[model samples]
Target: LQTIKNHLVEDMFASEGFRSDLFYDVQTRQNIVDVVKKNGKLKVNDATMTRCDLLNTNGVIHVINKVLLPDHHIED
Candidate 1:
């Protein structure tokens, strides 16, 4: 389960049309995505991006108002 979850999270790095690695949604489930599309803007979920792209020695960090999930409902 950990292996599969790891893969899912790895894939979620591209959901908002960019790369990300952090989620802090209070209402989102671990494997559920809440999409947001309004005013000609589209994001994977309604998550408000608080911060993004903080470079680190091992990787980058991103902060969002909601959690993210991989495309489980899409046919891949």
Candidate 2:
């Protein structure tokens, strides 16, 4: 369950386009993922982001189609 919760990022996308190779998740502060907007679509790592910037009182929400496991958490 903790792995799932770490998928939520601490930052919010305030614009329609952005790119970063060092975005940290809510948990596992040492873990990082890249966020990029390409061909008008948003992506996290190689996973496509189906939804972006769903706003709420707390923060923003973005949905991706694949599981983003931290490097240390991946099985060999």
Q: Top model by lDDT, which number?
A: 2
Question: Which consecutive 10 residues in model 1 have the weakest lDDT in total?
Answer: 6-15
Candidate 2 residue lDDT tens string, 1-76: 6556558656666537464532423233346666655567766666788887788899877777888766533211
Output the TM-score of candidate 2: 0.65
lDDT per model vs. reference: 0.41, 0.61
Error of 2 at 76 (Å): 21
After superposition, the stretches of candidate 1 with alpha carbons farther than 4 Å from their true spots are 1-44, 69-76
Model 2 gets an lDDT of 0.61
